[model samples]
Target: MTAILSVNRAQKKFSGLVAVNDVSFDVREGELLGLIGPNGSGKTTMLNLISGALRPSAGEIRLKDERISGHSAHHIARQGVARTFQLVRILPSMTAEENVMAGAVFARNRLWGADAHGLARKLLARVGLDGRADMPVASMTYIDQKRIELARALASDPRVLLLDEWLAGLNPTELQIGIALIDDLRREGRTIIMVEHVMDAIRTLCDRCVVMNTGTKIAEGDVAKVLSEPEVVRAYLGDDDDA
Candidate 1:
């Protein structure tokens, strides 16, 4: 598969602190890549850079050979990139369908009125929201809210989907459903980069893994191989027994 997205030596600084440091990786077309790490590992920062939520202090990000690192978030979204936040972001005042319609309205190829509404309903069902399209998002459960967000992202018809902790709050049953939903997307040949803490999902969904620690890339390869590395173990478990 061709490398659809590339982060080449990307770096981000916040004054004296560095959030992402010289990180580099390639996400191939139709690949589901896992970005895993402990808290404060610069994983989210890297996503922000790719999604254009934050500009990199150095280096570049390219989407299918086009430089996109310095573009605005909206620009990136319009250029076939869409994402779900670590915290589910839905319009509380809007119905599920309306929330999803917003994505279609401002997407890569903008849809409007009936077209957007039609697409929103289809996406809502795709993410298992089914008949709840008219329900207010604020009234939905956490998992349902997440589904809305996922549906919204999909509504954009993104070439690359970025999921930030999409499975973080699920119970065992919900976790299985969440994993299944993502797996379905993978089967559809969607290229995705997911940042998640659940090892089960990582093991089941990712074609490969990238491990980050304290703002730097530490490992990049097979899920089992990367997780077994001493540094990765230490990064998660710490050097001391308490970790």
Candidate 2:
């Protein structure tokens, strides 16, 4: 399968610290790829570079063979990329639908007025937030806020969706709902690259997985095999030295 997105020797630095170092990977079209790592292992930084929130200090990132590393985040979004944050990021003062409408307004071809509102309503309902559309996002529960943010991301009609720990705070029922939603998106052929710590979801949902450690990719392969690798285990659980 052809890759929908490629990170070719990508690197990022902040001051003298290297956040992402020579990380390279390919995300095949219609595949759900999991990026897993211990804390501060550069998974989120890699996502930032791909989403144009940060520029690579070296190398390139491409979406459909077009280099997108240096482009503005909005420019990349218009190129059919959309993402949700690790923390919920909705317009707290706005109604849930209004926040989703903001995303629709910037969608490729861009919807407006009644059309945007209609799409927002549908997206909200898709994420199980139908009746809460008019509620201020700040007044919603944490899981509801996450759903609103997800609805907003979908309002952009993205071909590639980057999810950053989107399932972090969910209860079991909500987790199942989130997993089902992702399964539906995969069936629709959306390419997804997710930074996730939820091992169950990664094991069940990822077509393949990449493990990162100290700014480098330590392992990449089938989920069970990758997770069982000694290096990956050490990265996550520490060696005898830490004991």
Candidate 3:
């Protein structure tokens, strides 16, 4: 598989602290890559950097060979990169359909009025929010809110998708649904980068994994192998007694 996204020794600094330190990785086209580590291990920071929420302090990030490290979030988004936040972002005052329409309007070429609304309905249905399209987002459950966020991101028709702890608050049934939705996206040839603590989901979904700690990559390769590494087990899973 060809590299669709590449981070060449990327770094992000806040004041004197380095949140991501010389991290490098390649996300291949049409593959699902998992990022896993304990809290504050720089997983979310990496995602944010790739999605253009934060510019790297040093080094370069490329989307299919086009430098995007220093671009603004909206510019990167417009270039076919989209992401979902760990905390779902939604317009509580608007109906689910309207929120999705907001995204659809800017999807490809600024769809307007009826065209945007029509696409919004289709996207809502795609994410299983069909009948609930007219319902206010404030009235939706946490999982449904997540679905709306996903639909909004999908409306953009992104080339690279970034998910930050998207499965954190899901219940069993919802978890299954979410897993299936991810599977469907993979089948559709979407390139996805997911930051998750759900080991089961990671094992089942990711073609490969990258493990980080203290803002640096610790281990990477096949999911099971990386998870089984002694250092990974110690740093991420803790001692046997603790587990």
Distance (Å) between predicted and true CA of 149, model 2? 0.7
Compute each candidate's TM-score over C-alphas. 0.98, 0.96, 0.95
Q: Which ten residues in a row have the lowest lDDT in candidate 1?
A: 234-243
Local lDDT at 86 for model 3: 96
Q: What's the lDDT for residue 136 in model 1?
A: 98
Q: What C-alpha lDDT, on a 0 to 100 scale, does residue 121 get in candidate 1?
A: 94
lDDT of the structure predicted as candidate 3:
0.90
Worst 10 residues of 2 by lDDT: 181-190
Cα RMSD of all models vs. native, in order, equals 1.0, 1.1, 1.7
- Quote model 1's TM-score: 0.98
> 47-135 in candidate 2: lDDT tens per residue?
89988999899999999979999999999999989999998888988999999999999987699999999999999888888787889
Model 2 clash number: 0
Best by lDDT: 1
Candidate 3 lDDT, tens digit per residue, 89-207?
Answer: 99999999988887777664567888888888998899888888899999899999999999988888888999998898999999999999998999899999999999989999999
Better of 2 and 3 by TM-score: 2
Model 3 spans with C-alpha error above 4 angstroms: 239-243
What TM-score number comes out for model 3? 0.95
lDDT of 2: 0.91
